[model samples]
Target chain A: MPTDHIMKTYDDELKRLNNAIIRMGGLAESQVAASIQATVKRDSELAHEVVEQDAQVDALEAEVEALAMRLLALRQPMARDLREIVSSLKIASDLERICDYAANVAKRSIALNQAPVAKPVYAIPRMGKLAQALIKDVLDAYVQGDADKAMHVWLSDEELDELYTSLFRELLTYMMEDPRSITAGTHLLFMAKNIERIGDHATNIAETIYYLIHGTPLKEARPKRDRSSTSVVLPGPVAVATTDSEETK
Target chain B: MPTDHIMKTYDDELKRLNNAIIRMGGLAESQVAASIQATVKRDSELAHEVVEQDAQVDALEAEVEALAMRLLALRQPMARDLREIVSSLKIASDLERICDYAANVAKRSIALNQAPVAKPVYAIPRMGKLAQALIKDVLDAYVQGDADKAMHVWLSDEELDELYTSLFRELLTYMMEDPRSITAGTHLLFMAKNIERIGDHATNIAETIYYLIHGTPLKEARPKRDRSSTSVVLPGPVAVATTDSEETK
Candidate 1:
């Protein structure tokens, strides 16, 4: 084949790979949303659907992996072509894990429904929606090949994390006041966490995008001191004692 | 370099990368464990230490990434070498996130202790221990290249998930009984979850290791249908509300 023909062929392969991933992502996004509903409404059937769909995701993951491997072995692609393949592998893994988290949420929802739940099912679904959008935005970024779009998705993670923190506080108090709340409270807490993890998976996709474009990580600016307006405090000066205990353990 | 010299040099470089990763794993594990103690004991200083130590983990992640890039460029190694380098990148990402989860747990601890906690804070610490060891063992499997060990650690994720689920349920029951327990219960929930996330990260590492050694994903046995003989009753049909309430807005 002529050099241009070879290049065109590789590009076509990459296009196919990206499309495959997008299809996989659609399933992943829906899985996340459905999982939230499953838990919120105690719909075990939706949970089963999410779990069963994981197999399809897995099959797609394998297909994409094979395509990526073929490109590497045959074309030895460079630059964006190579980056595209690497991103596919990472995205497949993230999507699979997001599904797992959704199933977990569904499972928890069923558990909480068994006995009267401690509190109204307030923040968990909101958290799930945020997570679902993160997945959607990241996938949109991939489809558009827009780095800025990916960056926007990355920023949303902070808000999700903050929401999770608030939810965590509420749940912890529930457990303490009535020991009975412990069982149902644990289920809700995991449901919230499953949503948080989905956010992390979305961030992973964004991070892969960063590497694909710049060959550098999405370098986070670490705060040297307390950056938040609120002065975040530690428990006490038990660092040494904790260190000793760690040693003994 | 002669082929033999090239072989030994490759081995040496791989060993250095492995050692650095193992050291990073140890540091990450300790960070998770200490963060748990900070939360359970309400030790603000240790919580600060955990937060401060996260920077070190981030730095280590960068160093690993830089080294992996050098190998990719300088060595021009084959697929096996490439797999090893990619595995390192994946593991660094996992470790960095685990550290973030730990820091989160510690931060929550500080928040919880500022007010009177409502529940007994016993299980989170133990969960942290299991999670930290999972990180350690997964790394050990990668370094020693024991696929079996890695698989063993991967299998334990289910048990960890169960523990977190139980903890969640207990917390919810508390919130249901009394409104007063909300805040403390939620904080404890976050603490348990951070530990649980550490276990998930460990599984991510093990999955990466399997890829590195096997030149593919480790063959996962068909995950049997979740008999879900526990709290979640599966196979429930979905019901849709055909109408929206007038107060929906």
Candidate 2:
């Protein structure tokens, strides 16, 4: 075959690999949305369906990995092509994690369904929607090689974090107000956390896309506002000591 | 230079890369240990030290990535060598995450230190020890290319999960017994979760090492016994209906 023909064939393979990534991303987004719906409607069947659907995402991840490896070995792609292939591997892994988080949400939804509805479940589903949208936008950016769109998705994760903080507080209140709510409230808390993590994974993909396009990672610190229990406040100069006796009381 | 000289140089570079990984892994393990000590002892200075130490891990990760990319682009290693370089990239990422989890734990320890001890903190320290050990063992496996040792680290994560479940139950009990405990209990819960996640990352490294040596993923499913709120029991053929009204009350 002529060199031009070989190059054309390589380009086609790259295009097919890109399509596979987008398909996996779409499946991941659907899993997140379906899991949230199952949680809100207390529909165990929908949750089960979401769990079953995760196998497709897993399979796609394997396919993307194999194809990317083949491209690397056969084509010996350099610079931009190298970045694209590597990013595909990284993005597929991130998508798989997102799918796992969604499946986790589905599992939690089933557990929550068995228990009483502890508190009004509004914020978690909102966070889920935000996470799902972020996944869509990032995958679009991946397809278009649009760094701007990827940055937007990356910056928007703070909203999901804020929503997670509020939900964390509300769940704690519910569990505190009525001890009977503890079991179900805990499940909701984990589900909310799963959604928040899904948002993080979406941002991860955005970073990968940005790197693929720009040949450099986003330099700024990730925009983060998760004020949950793990949110770290850097200590002031000297550790301010509170009276231990007063705290124990 | 002869082909033998070029091969020698490549081997040396690979050795340097492996050393960097082990160094990063050690820093991560120390960070985890310090964070746990700070939490248990309520030593804010120790926590601050752990937080500050994370920068080294981050720098090491960047170095590892550069070296791995250089090897990939210049050497174009194939088969096992390719897997080794690729797995180094992945293991470095996981170590970075483990370091972040440790830093998060330290930050939470500072936050929790301001409040009275919510409950006896026995289980969390034990879980931290287990997580730290897993990090150490997995990294050792990486250095020795010991798949069996890596598998041991991977299988041992279930113990961490079980410990986390018991700690979750204990913390919930403390919060329910005293509303004032909620503040501290929440922080402890997050710390426990951070430790649990560190263990998960260690398992991720184990998986990578297993893949690196065997050229195939471990066939068995990851052993998981996290009976936390997220653990799901699939519904039977017939949905077992509970008295929802009683649960609400």
Candidate 3:
């Protein structure tokens, strides 16, 4: 009876840890959504709210860390339990980073508001929506212990990357065509990059969830389609001409 | 004698874990330096090499993770050993990310070489050198268990951020002035941001080391001076004149 009681208590603690991560994930999801809305609306107050809410995510991470450490030290959990605990820590860290990137998008949105919104600025909310979906799906995967769902999120990151690459080119063209848009364009570019990175953190969480359920890291190389790192958009007449063609399309 | 022998073996495993982190740290340092060299010298071959070396860092991270998990399960390490083990996992993850940023810089460098070099490119090596030093000093702090030294690296991040802010403004002005430079300037902008992020990972490692040694998180607010997020440089006369004043100075 005593052992059964202790086992129940351990289960409760583990559930508490899981709930903390889920709560943290919810905060991250909201922050990303709010930041994107703020960027699109040019609403500084909403941006500030996103920034303020990030502290809560950070606090949740600290709380999860403490509880995880205590469980590891006291419970001496083994096998699946140990993996679950470790994955929780990793997942929390990724969620914390996701929130940070969202806050960064908000910060840039504040600066971006100073200038007239660039045409490419509209691409952000689309990208933001994709990243938000990924976060939501990955958290659901975590909650359900659904490796298939997690794997789906992992593979879907490629679409986000492709979207980002196209947006990168568009932003560069917009900036070069109207030098006036450079300030806004650059801020929007970084904001897009930040959202792209949030998609990445969601991929990271998906991987952690897969590992937690399967006990092995995803072996194949993750599909990395974010060629924006190596992307080049030439300036002057050529870039402007390209934009002109696109506009006709 | 049996307990003593087990204790000695446990000590050996911990030492090996520490050495693996040090080795991993060395790889990260080399990747950053080589990437920077490639960027400054426009050496595509060296950049390729930096990209190739990133896999080794990734492999080491997996190895560290495996070993840490094994130790936790078998050793049931408590208190300081547990903290050290956990910190190793965290530090390895940071180093892995540092290498990823370095690889990204390399990737961007390859693209950057396609265009004629931008003048702002010269500042990359300065930033790179600073990031390289922070990595080196932070690793030494980890090795020596020197919290004070770790704090030093932690604080030095502000200088790197300040440098990045100036480089950012300069790059934006250059791009607006000559659209031809936009291609190279954007690449350089990303490369500089990559190096700045490397500095951030060093600060993360320093914090991990501090926690490992002191068993308490640094309570003070980390001084963050990277205002480039909200930084804006308008296009046209205002920005050009700002550059002109700086040129005279």
- TM-score of chain A considered alone, across all candidate predictions: 0.84, 0.90, 0.94
Deviating ranges (above 4 Å) for candidate 1: A2-9, A36-43, A112-130, A157-189, A222-249, B1-16, B115-119, B156-181, B221-249
For residues A109-197, write the lDDT of model 2, one tens digit per residue: 87788666656477777888899889999988888889999999999988888788767766766656666566576667777878888
- Across A76-175, the per-residue lDDT of candidate 1 in tens digits comes to 5565666677678778878877877776676556556666655737788788888988999999988887888888887778778767655655555545
- True-vs-predicted CA distance for residue B69, candidate 1, Å: 3.6
| Preferred candidate (TM-score higher): 1 or 3 | 3
Give candidate 1's iRMS in Å, 1 decimal: 11.6
Q: Show where candidate 3 strays beyond 4 Å.
A: A237-249, B239-249
Order of all candidates by DockQ, from best down to worst? 3, 2, 1
Indicate whether candidate 2 or candidate 3 has the larger TM-score: 3
Query: Best candidate per TM-score, number?
Result: 3
List the pairs of residues colliding in candidate 2.
none
* Candidate 1 CAPRI grade: incorrect
lDDT of each: 0.69, 0.78, 0.86
The backbone clash count of each candidate, in order, is 43, 0, 0
- Model 3, residue B25: displacement in angstroms? 0.3
**Residue pairs of candidate 3 with colliding backbone atoms:** none
lDDT of 1: 0.69
As for lDDT, the candidate ahead, 2 or 3, is 3
DockQ of each: 0.14, 0.29, 0.44
